[model samples]
Target: MTQGLDQQHPQEHRDRAILETITQEGRSDYNLVELARLYIRYDNFPGARQIQQDLQAILAQWNLTVEELFTLTRAIHQQGQIYRRTKSGEDIQDWS
Candidate 1:
């Protein structure tokens, strides 16, 4: 239950780091998007949706254009397709 970062597999360590940062800052469009993607992959659908809503609010606060929103959403979707966000925190490369 309490694995040390050094003890974790490299991929697991990186995965845990990302999750931690997301919780710690939970700010910035980039971080939110990444967290959302991870949530989606990890089967936390509601959390992912919430992050998306947060993303929308962030975009609105910045006065971004519809075109910008479309672009960002597209990129996020594409990434979700590319990366298999697993709860195990396994390294993507290790899949091979």
Candidate 2:
């Protein structure tokens, strides 16, 4: 006769469950820069401006500059484009 065995550690099982939940819920970017870009790209100017205001509030909270925020926004936009292209299986041509 054969006996059944329990193989999963409690912590490992909990971690896997948590990860599955998060993956099913999808990715969320709470960063204002990314939120603003999403709004702007979709032609939601009012929403984008609202997010900009929120970004300003965050900047004030962290004592950061508008220039730094712009830089972050640019980087996020670049990464988004790359991600989109990759997801769509489109060839990205480098003209540099």
Candidate 3:
């Protein structure tokens, strides 16, 4: 299942957190070209700047541009990664 960015997994490393936070939620397909814009929007919030820096570092490490990373993430998310859960905390697949 595609994990929502609102909850951080304890085992997730720092670089992974940055990628998930910026891309995994709250986006329009049209905004993919401007994916980095959210960093500017959230810059005033506490800890956001550090995230921006970390994202840059991750890009450098992976030798990827922002657009490339977005494409990759979008493909992964599209591949049946998203799932729904019931309010009682049951997987949707269980109800099928």
- Give the best candidate by TM-score: 3
Candidates ranked by lDDT: 1, 3, 2
Top lDDT: which candidate number? Answer: 1
Local accuracy of candidate 1 as per-residue lDDT tens digits, 1-96: 222322323244455566666656755656645644543443323233434454455446556654664566577767764455567875343321
Model 1 TM-score is: 0.33
Residue 83 Cα positional deviation in candidate 1, in Å, after optimal superposition: 13
lDDT against the true structure, per candidate, is 0.50, 0.43, 0.47
Cα miss at 48, model 1 (Å)?
Answer: 16
Point out the higher-scoring one by lDDT: 2 or 3: 3
Question: 78 in model 2: Cα distance from truth in Å?
Answer: 0.8
Task: Give TM-scores for every candidate, taking all chains together and pairing residue i with residue i.
Answer: 0.33, 0.31, 0.40
Count of residue pairs whose backbone atoms collide, per candidate: 0, 0, 0
Model 2, span 33-73: residue lDDT tens: 44333323423232334333444454576455756656666
Q: Taking the tens digit of each residue's C-alpha lDDT, what string does model 3 give over 1-96? A: 222323432323543453565455534432332334443333343443445565566556557787676676567558742446679766543110
State in Å the error of residue 6, model 1.
Answer: 23
Candidate 2 colliding pairs: none
Off by over 4 Å in 3: 1-47, 82-96
